[model samples]
Target: MTTYNPNQDAHYQILREMLIEARQARGMFQKDVAERIEKKQSHISKYEGGERKLDWIEVLQLIEIFELSEVDFLMEFQRRVFEFNESTQTKVLQNVAKNAAKKARVRAEIVRLMRENSLSFSDLAEPPIRTRRHKSNR
Candidate 1:
């Protein structure tokens, strides 16, 4: 029999966490994702917990299930994992800076959308109610 290593490296852990976070942010649970990917809930749980490793095919499945952009998603995942697990603290700082920059970009996009949609504070406020006229007056 051929030997196989699951290689549950930090990279795999980061990717797994990203997948779980994406699903959670969409109000999805492990069962929901498992159903979409045609896998068992336990499989997803194990994968997310980093107790089990994913193969190449599984990685592709995860990307699809999470609706991740192939180019940026994979690249960022690799970069963050490498930085996080690297022996050098400088790499970790670089990762932190990159993450902060990404957050700022996302916040800017949200602001742009709010402006484009003209969503003012009143948009979220409750409307005033008018008093009902009594039919007894007629």
Candidate 2:
């Protein structure tokens, strides 16, 4: 028996959605894509319905049939996989901006500390010195 994997299922679902969207966006029907890829309409339907997974070759074929460049197809796939609603996407962008600002502040602090301490690139290149120990007589 095969166990169900939610992650894998989600991945297939995203791919299926993107495939259907791309086909529709290009004003192509499933039948047309099926004919181009040498597959039956049912095969295209099954793939779009997430009942079947497309192998890499089939994906490449679909990309060609849809008249999409490989980069365009992959970019659409990525966009669908990480899609978010407008509000949520806005929040995420805001968080990213905040994080970037925080990083800039941290870098400024490091530069200030280095300057105040008179630190130089040569200091970083040199190795630490070890002290010698005297031998004791028994």
lDDT, candidate 2, residue 22?
80
Model 1, range 1-138, lDDT digits (tens) per residue? 956533346567678777777788778899998898888999889988988888878878767777777777778887876777565567668999999999999989877887999876576475768799778954
**Predicted candidate 2 versus true structure: per-residue lDDT over 1-138, tens digit per residue:** 999865567768877877788899999898988888788999999989877888998888887877879997788777765663444568879999999999999989877888999987687679989899999998
Off by over 4 Å in 2: 1-4, 83-138
Scored by CA lDDT, what does every candidate get?
A: 0.78, 0.82
The true-structure Cα RMSD of candidate 2 reads 11.6
Output the worst ten-in-a-row residue range by lDDT, candidate 1: 2-11
Best by lDDT: 2
Any runs in candidate 1 off by more than 4 Å, and if so which? 1-8, 85-138
The most accurate candidate by TM-score is 2
